[model samples]
Structures are given as C-alpha cells and as structure tokens.
Target: MSGLAALCFLLLQTGACGFEILGWFFRGKSLTHEDITERAILNTTVQVCRALALAEGKDFTFPPQPFTAESVAVACGASKSSKSFCKAISLIQRKNWNVDLFRFYSSRHHFDDETFIEGRKIITEGLSAVKASNKRENFEAAREKLGNILHPLQDFYSHSNWVEMGNNLPNPNLIRAGTSIGNIAGKYNVTVCLDEIEKRNA
Candidate 1:
C-alpha cells in the first residue's frame, strides 16, 4: 500500500480516518451545507498553513484529513486547547446551518427563488464585514460573518449556471468590486444542465 493508504489503514483501526469515514457515510446522500462548509474550512486552513510554512522556509506537517480545529490549531502552531479558534469553528458552522433555519424567509440568502444578484450582494457585504471585523481584532465577529456569507456563496454553484458556463473553478470576480459575476440565469430563463441535475436528484 502507499504511505497514505497505510496510514489510513492504521487510523481506520482507531476510527480516525475522518474523510474516509465521512465519504462512506455520505456515499449516496447529497452533502449538507454544514458538510460542505466544514470541508472548505479545513481546506482553507491547510492551504494557509502550507503557504505560511513556505514563507518561513520550514517543513510543515499537515493535520489529518478532514481536519478539525484542534488539529489545525496544533499544525499551525496554536495551542491544541485554544478555545477561541474552536469557538470560531463552531460559530461558523452554526451560522452556516442557521441560514437554513432563521434565514428561510430570505430566499436570496440561500440563492433560492432565483435571487442571484441579491445573493451576490450578501456575499460582497459579508466579505467587507469580515475584513472590517478583522481590522478591529474582532476575530469572532469576522468568523461569524464568514459563516453567514459561505451559505449563499456555496448555494450559488448549486442553484446557478456558473458551472454549465464551462468554468470548473470558483468565480474570482465574486469578491472583486464592480465586476460582473457573469450572466446569471433568471427565473424565466432556465439554467443549462440544471434540469439534468434535478432529474438525477429525483
């Protein structure tokens, strides 16, 4: 077996193969926003740590797959018992889930009801909020706002034609001011390949 495969086999004995286990559990089911958000969070954390390590000209060991806040904290040189970072993780996850609950009345918050432009506006404003909060050293508030925005930002891919437009990567323009996010599919207009996805879902 390869090194990663051997490690996964060992971790499996301890029930610590996080992504392996999650992949099995969610095999047939569609990923919830919480799952997606957590995965993205872990990925972002790992990439940032990698970049920082490179800048410092140091070797960086990655935390286990599907990293938790504690693991990431340790890998990034923060205390594993750090409450603030863990709290930030929980706050972000809760905010991501809350959109399904409290924000149900606002379809644009979920990129539902064909409110594409409004959803983009929420992301733009939320990004600004994150920056402003960070500027004030309100890390908790910044994380909260990040979680709030991630919901609609993620929903855009699920509910729109950014994919069918032949782009495999995320839209960079979403964060750029005054730039178009490309042509959005309207309520009256049908998004290409969306019907195929619905058919698959059904």
Candidate 2:
C-alpha cells in the first residue's frame, strides 16, 4: 500500500478521520452525542410547555434559540439546578466517559457491534427504572436512569444509518416495548460509501 493509503487506514482505525471524512454525510454538522441529546431535551420540553400553556389558556413563550438548560428552566418555571434538568444533563454527558470506564466500549452503549436488541433493552429498562424512581419521588435516581438511557438512545442515530435509510423521522418503535425496531444491517454490510470517504479524505 502507498504511504497515504496506510495513513488513511490508520486514521480510520483510530476514528481520527471522523468529521473530516463524514461531514458531508451529516450535512457538515459534527453533532456530538451531548449536542443531539441537549437539543432533543430542549425541543421536547418546549413542546410539552406549549401543550400545558394551551390547556391552561396561557401563552407559551419559547426560551429562544441556542437553548441551554438554564434558559429552558427559566422559561418553564423550573430551577436550572433541578435534578431533573441540569443534573440530568451532567449525568447524560458522563455516559460518554463514565459508564464502563476502562472497559471495552459496550456495543449496547453506542448501538455499535450490531447489538440493537440488547441496546433497545437497555433503553426500555432504563426508562422503566426512571419512571419507577420518579413515582417514588426520587428525582435524583430518576435523573440518573434517564441519563443512562439518553446516551445509548442518541448513539443509535449517530451510529446507525437511519437517516441514510430514508428515515425522515425517528423510529418510534425504539421507545415502545414489544415492537420490532426494524431490520438492522449486519456488521459486514457496507452501509456507507467507503470509497467516497477515502477519496474525500485523500
């Protein structure tokens, strides 16, 4: 192999060619797991707040763009340091480094290694635990459980070809138990254009 080819292979193995080689695929946006999770949380919170306002005959004011936990908390009349919000964000971010630290990256954690079934179970079980804790008024425990699930859930989109598969929306079945999450490509499947990636990097 040429020196450049060997270097490219090495970079690929180390994930050093990530955004530079795959940016076009994601519309040139290199959203980290935390970024996507935070956005999702903010969006969902806004939607819920709007619904509540409508039901109570009040105006729902959005927290404004570049949303952060503090802004959303203020708009929603919650404390920024609420264990349900800001602390949850911290826990979710830690999943990228804290969970299984010093151990091999679990397939279920990043939706890698084609462990979709196991990964889904992790999410479902975590959600259940969160709900149970919340029912008992244990917000701290609920936040931890929620954070654990969000990490893997967000990783599914980042690691999978859901968008490339022509999915315009999220796979709703992922959150629902006892439903098929759809057929997943096996590990050997060439879901991405490796040659295009190589050419772009080269």
Candidate 3:
C-alpha cells in the first residue's frame, strides 16, 4: 500500500480518524478551534508514525494518549522550536487558516495554476521527507507541515459543492495535475455562518 494510504488506514484505528472526518458534523461547533486543528495534526501524526512502524516492521503506539497539542507542548516544552510550533498550531482560526493557498487548489478555483503547482510540490517534498527520514523530530515536523497542506484539501470537501456537483463524488482532479476540476465554477465557494462580534464586544 502507498504510505499515505497506509497512514490513513492506521490513523483510523486511533478513533481520531472518525473525530477528524466526522466530528465536524456533530461536534464542530462544540469543538474548540484548537481541538479541530489539533485533532487533524494528531491524526496525521499517527498516520506518519504508523507508516514508519510498518516500514520498520514493528508495532507502534502513541503514549500520553488522546494526543492533544497541549499535551505535546507540555511534554516538549523545553524545546523552543516545539513550543513555537505548538503555539502556532493552536492558533488555527476557521476563516484565516491556510487562507493564501486555499484559493489556488480547486476546479472551482484556478484548475491547477502556479499556486496549485507550488502547493503540490511542497506536499510531495514533505511526504518524501516524512517517509525517507530516520529522525523522529524531523518526521514530526514534516508530518505537521503535511497536515497543514492537507487541511485545505480536505476542506475542499467541506467548503465546496463537489459532492453535489460531481454526483456525490469527490473531484479527484483536485489532487492531480493536468485535469479540470469538473464543471465547477471559477472559484471554490461555500456559505458558512461565522459567529460575529457580539454587541458587548462592539
């Protein structure tokens, strides 16, 4: 199996897989913004770790279970880079996270432009780094970066109507090069309701 597929399959065993994919439906609003992003990171990390374990022909388990960014931050608190990374990760806001790259990757958006090409290049490099490296720390960093890149790709499902427009299927072209994103509009669009500043705050 491909490393990415194997990673995802293993991540599903962690229960975080369900949380990351389906939790957005029932628990999205209940989940803290950090919970949403951190869950994605945790699951993605599990996938990478599992893939590494498989490659090494060993079993693996992530301790300090129910892996939260807070727990990891505390555990790696002494490392300045880990602390900075964790802090930055916790700041993923709904409207602002991955804002720049979000527009470049879609049949609805640009259908494979410079931004899209660059994004894919980065992800391919990140995945290669994760799979080919023996350094745990480097793997962790690469996993986090890969998750960040993937965050918006997954968001493509939540943010756009490909499921409807493409007959309840995903626009597979979004992940590939030299293909149209179906008959999507010129931009990927979704109507989401955001909590506005309260009158008290105003």
Candidate 4:
C-alpha cells in the first residue's frame, strides 16, 4: 500500500470514533472507540461468567478478543456469540447506511421520547438475564440488545438543546417514567445557521 494509504488504515484501526455524537460515550470513559467496545464486551462477558459460575459451578473465562464476535464466542464457549453476532455489530456500527447512526442522530425522535422506551427495556432485560442466569446464549443475547441502546442514549446530549437551556447539567430525568423533561419552549425562536450569518451582517 502507499504510505498515505497505510497511514489511513493504521489510523482507522488506532483512532477513536471522533464523530461527535458517537464519541460522547467514550469521552469520559475511554480514549478510543476500540477501548469502549472492549470494555462493554468485557462487562457482558464478566457478568455472564460470574452468573454462570455461581449458578452452575462453571469457571469464568475472559473474552478472547477486543473485536470479532467469533473471538468472544471462543472465550464464552458459544458457537459464535450467536449465529450472526459479529456481522451484526459490524453492520450496526457501519458509517453510512447504518440504522444505529440514523436513529441515534434523529433529534425529533428525541432521546427521552416515550416511544424510545424499548431501548431501556432491552438493556434492563439483558442485564437481568446476565445477572441471574447460567445460559451463555441468554447472556450474550442480552449483551447484544443492550449494545444497541447505548449509542442513542449518549447521543441524547449532543442532539438536544440541553446545553443551551442555561443549565450545565443534563436533565436527570430524561428517561424516567412519569417525569418531565421540563417545559419545552412553545416557540422555535432560537437562531441557527443562516440566521447567524444574517444576524452577523445585520
């Protein structure tokens, strides 16, 4: 490969997800996207191992890789994390035409919208099974489901005007049932983009 091409590929492998919305999750937690993924997979694997060890007297085995569901399966003694796990993770996190990105960046479908309750439910169910069951299949299933929810949850902050509402903190009640996200402005009076250019000229 050409020098520039090799550098780009190296960067791709070594670089973090610098996309603002996606990177938000890793900002306070890990320096790179790979690290974040490894951490999450490890968390799921550890939880499953712990639960399995407790429920069935099995030994805990760590995840074998930071990428590829196949490696995770080897570590967990599953067939392949699932029939289609690694492929799904790849497709889900793909840059263009990825449903994960589309939904995560969808602002009007606001993060706190009640319609999005399914995401939280997925996480809760997955975690509950991972914590209480000896089934590796069930545990991995939960991990995958929970995996799909996190991007949008982190994207909630970047896509909304929460930073503009004069509060330095995110709304603590974003997804809680029966809680308010506060009274949204009845008017869309905020200036943006072209307005800013016009105002500057005015």
Each model's Cα RMSD: 10.1, 12.5, 11.5, 12.1
Q: Give the TM-score of candidate 4.
A: 0.41
lDDT of 1 at 89: 70
Q: lDDT value for candidate 4?
A: 0.44
Q: Which candidate's lDDT is highest?
A: 1
Q: Please, what is the whole-model Cα lDDT of each candidate in the order they appear?
A: 0.67, 0.61, 0.46, 0.44
For candidate 3, lDDT tens digit of each residue in 107-140?
3322132344444444445456655642555554
Give one digit per residue, the lDDT tens place, for model 1 in 35-109: 666666656666677777999999999988768878888888886555777676778878877776788779898
Q: Residue 124 deviation, candidate 4, in Å?
A: 11
Task: Kindly report the root-mean-square deviation of model 1 from the true structure over all alpha carbons.
Answer: 10.1
How high is the lDDT of residue 164 in model 2? 56
Instruction: List ranges where model 2 is wrong by over 4 Å.
Output: 1-29, 79-85, 100-104, 186-202
| Candidate 1 displacement at residue 164 in angstroms | 3.5
Candidate 4 RMSD computed on C-alpha atoms after optimal superposition onto the true structure: 12.1
Task: Point out the higher-scoring one by lDDT: 2 or 4.
Answer: 2
Higher-scoring candidate on TM-score, 2 or 4: 2
